[model samples]
Target: MSIFLIFALSKINYARTLIYIFHLATIPAIFAGAALTATSIGITGKVLAEIGKLSAKEGQIIIGAAVLDDILGIIVLAVVASLVKTGEVQISKVIYLVISSSAFVVGAILIGRFLSPFYVQLVNSMKTRGQLLLVSLIFAFILAYIAQVIQLEAILGSFAAGLVLAETEKRSELAEQVFPIADLFVPIFFVCVGAKTDLSVLNPAIPSNREGLVLAAFLIVVAILGKVVTGLAVFSKEKLNRLAIGVGMIPRGEVGLVFAGVGAASGALSPATDAAIIMMVISTTFIAPPLLRLVFKEPTGSPQSVSSEQ
Candidate 1:
């Protein structure tokens, strides 16, 4: 929804500029779309844990879909970033990226499933006791490198590596070993995202920044709508609470900020546009969690009333 809305809004606001120089308009629009691509599983996961619903069916669906959503987001980013550099949205390129990224993810899981036994055997044969952990990290990095080599996002490779690792019997042990490393690094990443954001651009006192503030406000509405609409995608396999699931998917959090930061660094997002994107991220992050908790509390409430509470 953000992608479609931002692209439509961009055309309205920047169509003349786009006509004169397509790259100028499209890159920023791409940034807007990219910013909305991924959800922060951390936020959703914490909410689920807090509600004691982590083991519930809705939780399982949300968590599972979120991983796939992240993968798809990376693929979208790769395709859009490629378009920015090339200054054209080539269908062939998009198709290739879609196929390659999907194949990479699916292939990794299928191949990993078969090779997991051999991997276990190999790990046992190694003389080093801690080699399993080292191997897993190396594997993720190697996949990241390979992804870069293939003109895809490195996250694609790393995520695939993770999927592969997940199939192994040692996944729980590996996760335990890696949890500390994640705790160490994740904060630094968010810090960098904050550092890159020019808060001045969000200041309403500045006449020039007001436009971005307006855009941010508009983006916020669609961002919420985009995630909320995902509830409709739920299969009717059981009497599931779709509102709670959709609300669970609402927070963009760190992942959106990360995308915005990267776009700024790459020059795809102008300062004003970057500020708008950041605000969009912040709005969703702040709004989604509390609203999610509320909707979950009253799952049978009308959508109108549920949304009004937010």
Candidate 2:
């Protein structure tokens, strides 16, 4: 979603002309950002770690919003890539990507509607939870591969599989059974994200020149503003604080960084540029909690605030 904005602003030779004019800069910026995204145990760790403290209401809705952002990020990258590659603004590809994505969404709904109940029965019948692990992992991988084979994003495939499984009778059990794997591999993903960022450059001890700070400031604005608008995506007045909900959903985490990584490796961005984008991510994530908390007021009918004994 932000990438679409970036691509658009870059076209105007305005906001991000720094990025477009020096294609070299975008190279490393993209990878470093990706490494931070896919590799960093980012906001995922934060969200997971916050389990139980927030309402069950909090966990489910927050996670759903994040997943929405994740899916949107993937679509943004695919659409941008198509635009760049074809040079024709192929309306056909835009249609295809949307149709394909919708198909995945529809397919997942069907799985939940039909296939998941069968899975519920199967999981229920298991003697030990171990077999569910094997079966689920295999299923997820197969679906992911199928998505890739179909010229769709693998994460989309995997996410679709997860979403379907999420709505099943045994959603809680399934998440619990596989958390071991999620814990191990997931952190590496986050750390790898951190690994890509050489913060040393930002240190006053090194590349910490005034210019770097100035540039970092600019990037911060870009990053923060980029996601702030996404809050508008929420039009609901029920349950959660819409602004907080939107703020909570702002962290770019894995997918944004992954796009940066791809762009860099493919010579789309330079190292310094990649670092700038990473800074943007950091600012946005860092800003999320405070902003969210600021906007947080227990909604009408909220479990705690409105119902509390005054």
Candidate 3:
């Protein structure tokens, strides 16, 4: 849907306007499309919890769908990154990337599942401080390095490592330790993203900047509509809050920033395009919490039920 919207706009006078006004190129436009497809599990999950719906059926479905969305988004990121690297799309290369990325994630999880018992035993035998954390980081980095060697994103490997570790007995303990590390690194990551983004393009005072603002608006609309429609795709006999499910998938949050950062660092995105993406990210992230609260509203005396079938 996003790709079609981008490409369709590119063929019209709007495309020419984008090129002349916003300096958006075909590749960056497509990159923007891919970026639009992301749903931030972090923000969405937090919002669901805040609204007292985190354990509800709608929340569970949204969480599961968001996880799948991130994985698929990562795969799309790999393919898009390759396009940025080579400067042209090769059907064969795309095919290889799609296959290799899917296989790598699946294989890593399967192999890691088998190895997790030994990993647990190894940690159990260790008397050193932070042994579990240290070993887990090592495992994650090893997979990350392997992913880099395979020409895929290191984050993909890290994600797969996380999936593997999540299945272990020490999952809760590991998460407790990992949170501090995530706290330390996640800010730095966002800092880098903010530093790389040229915010001047978003200013309305400058005539040239207006184009980017307009582009950002277009992207925001596409981003919201694209995910909102996913609710309709739910095929179920239960009377579920499909609107809540769709709204839950709205926030782009950190994941969207990663895409923007990658595009900026790769030099695929023009300054205007980069700014537009950043704006889209911020807008979606902020809007989702309130929108979610509104959509999940229940009657004062009624039970907080997510589905009639529940």
Candidate 4:
């Protein structure tokens, strides 16, 4: 889907207008398309909980798929960030990135798994306040620093740390401790992105800005259709709420914003292109939750019958 979006959006003249005007290159278009591939597990999970489907099979599937999507998206972001830094695409570098990224994630999980029992034991033995939280943060930061040293995204390492620690007995407690940290830092991150973004490109009153508006509209359509079609991939003898699954995957949320932020910061994206990507993210994030609720609200069969059929 990411590849298709990159190719398809790049080929469209409207989508490339801002890119041609500012960057005189296709990388911004690529960023725009790549940004579309992100699905926010945070938003999706919340919606699933709201609709009383978080524990349901479809909900579980979407959540798991979103996690995979995020991991892959982070890898893609790393590759794109590298491309921006080097200003060229080298197949050898790309291959190396792919291999190293996979290895970093897999290696981290394996090593962390082996060490997790000790990790749990150490935390349990600590009588100091906030010991578990501090240890977890230290572990995550170490992995994140290692990722940076290895030229991969730090978020990937943090995410890998999360996966490993989630298997431990303190998963719930760790999550509780992390919530306040996320609440504090996440908003600051968004605020920084907003401060850096040139919102003037989105103004329709300006003639040139109209192109960006058009580009944003195009992206919004592609973003919606791109994710909605993913629902059809579920192949099973028993019926499932495939539409719900797809809709659940549609919100780009903070993940999409991260792509846009990286693109803008790297100077790979023009103001118009960056604005368009941001608009696409905002549109998808807002649109998906209600659509998901509506889709799941539809009559597909009783839960009992569906379970029996499964």
Candidate 5:
């Protein structure tokens, strides 16, 4: 993190002023939409439910943050495509991206917010076969394909599809059916991420070739801090512990893997960069469950906590 760099230099107590000035000037140089893309799927809500902790107060907060993080990512990625073709600065991109992102957001919002619910309601109103499962998969794939057509990630489309399913009256039935399928493929995504590493890149043997390392370090920081900041959105002055909620949302699961895979596919990521990215993903995922479990644990004799504790 350049933010951390400022602090690190502060510890040396030498010419910090110049460093801060340069840093301040350069921050405005970042690509806003690209910078805003989050680390990826936090332990999505279904994970918490399977662990039997969804009802806990803290679990609810974690799930809320994770959901918000996903929402922020969708908006960010939609905007990122617009900003890229026209490499404007962050401030300018903000305006252009908002307008660009709107159509995608509105379209998704219509499906997620209105159509999916109505469809589920209509389906529930029927006594037909359980082909709702097939219908949903078709919808997910169609949206995924559309996301690709728009120069966005298929995962983003899938997530939007997920949100629609989440809001539907068939949420329970749909979740029960789809989660088993997600469970099967999702871990493959993660394991593949771990598999793609070229350890030689992460090696410090060629310290002279430092550019890849620099980019890796910068991107990892963005990946973590961006999502963490968004996770804090789950709280206000009167509600959940914002820090805990944010921390719980820190783990980047399938989302990060998909990002790395995409970057590699795009030829934008080098071998060393891929290794570094995989390491970052592993760290976040390893830390998340334990941190969440700790923070979400309630004091003794609490029935709600007991019932929800995994």
Candidate 6:
């Protein structure tokens, strides 16, 4: 909602005796929305861990909501990418895309639910070392591939795979083995993303890049507000530090960067626009942690966290 409102307001042409801008800037609007839709799970999780609140009520809420946010972000990315690829923004087409993407995710999780027990049993019966971890990874990759084939983002499939694995009794062991691999590869992936960014686009000396900077400013405002609003919407019997959760969700970290990188690679976003997205990511990353620390400095000591009973 924030992204759409900001993009629409930014391109307003009130001088023409109208309250809105023309549809000529549709692609840019999509890119702007896509850039703001991302949230950095890595950063949010780390902040929760660093503050020793991962098991706390507010922390758990942020973690669960952040997972959903990431899934939604990827779905948004797929929709925007499809729009750019088709070069048309028909409302019907968009509706179909959204429904399909959502159904695909839901279906994967449902299927995984029924099959997970059998899958775990099969893996346990295997006569191989690291069978559980190996099967878990293969399942993730397979789901990812299926998602791509079905026009949804691969992240959706991986997330579904995670859902499946979480239902298994060996989740702890799987995490033990998988954490090392993730720790090793995740930094390498981010390094590659950083290396691909063209810094020249951000240089102020370039007169053409100035417009993107203005757009970036607008995006930053909306991005911050969008997440903050999420924090405030925590409805529970136990009082939660809503502001803290909101700030916790602020950093776009790697997710924002990945979306911008994909946009640039697909030619859906111009160099200047990509630079703007990168700047927004950097600003949010630098701002969110300190703000969260400040908000959560003294625990409110709420009676209950967000539990299943709630």
- Where is the poorest 10-residue window by lDDT in model 6? 11-20
Over the stretch 154-200, how does candidate 3's per-residue lDDT look in tens digits? 88888888889999999999999999988999889999899888898
The candidate with the higher TM-score, 1 or 4, is 4
lDDT of 6 by residue, 1-310 (tens): 4433432343232112111332225665666666665667777777677767778888887777767667777777776776777777899988988888778777877888888789978997999998888888899999889877877667767877887788778888888899999899888977886777776776678897666666667668767987787567666778788888788888988888878877777787777677778888999999987777668775553333212112
Predicted candidate 5 versus true structure: per-residue lDDT over 32-110, tens digit per residue: 2132233334463544564465665656766654555456655554454334444444876566555545565567868
Q: Please give, for residues 123-205, the per-residue lDDT of candidate 4 as tens digits.
A: 99999999999999999999888988888777778878888888888999999999999999999999998888888999999
TM-score, one value per model = 0.84, 0.66, 0.88, 0.86, 0.67, 0.82
5 against 6, candidate with superior TM-score: 6
How does each model score on lDDT?
0.74, 0.55, 0.80, 0.80, 0.56, 0.73
Ranking by TM-score: 3, 4, 1, 6, 5, 2
Hey, what RMSD does candidate 1 come out at?
Answer: 5.6
Q: On residues 1-310, what C-alpha lDDT tens digit does candidate 1 reach at each position?
A: 4323433343234323432433347567766766665678989888777766667788887787677667666666666665566666678987887788778778888988998898888877889878888888888999889888888777778878998998899899899999999999989988888787888887999898877777777678767876677665565669988888778887888878867866787677888788888888888888877887777778655564444332
Cα shift from native, residue 234, model 2 (Å): 5.3
Top-scoring candidate (TM-score) = 3
Candidate 2 lDDT tens digits, 1-310: 4433433333234223444533324323323323222212246336434432245454445565555445555554544443334444456876787677768767766866787767767766878748777767777888778777766656666777777777776678778977888889878976886787665555555553544555567656545444445444444555545454445656665566666554544445445555666676666667765564445543433455423323
**What are the candidates' C-alpha RMSDs?**
5.6, 6.4, 4.8, 4.7, 7.3, 5.9
Clashes of 1: 0
Better of 4 and 6 by lDDT: 4
Q: What is the lDDT of candidate 2?
A: 0.55
Q: How far is candidate 6 from the true structure (C-alpha RMSD, Å)?
A: 5.9
For model 3, the superposed segments whose C-alpha errors exceed 4 Å read 1-24, 298-310
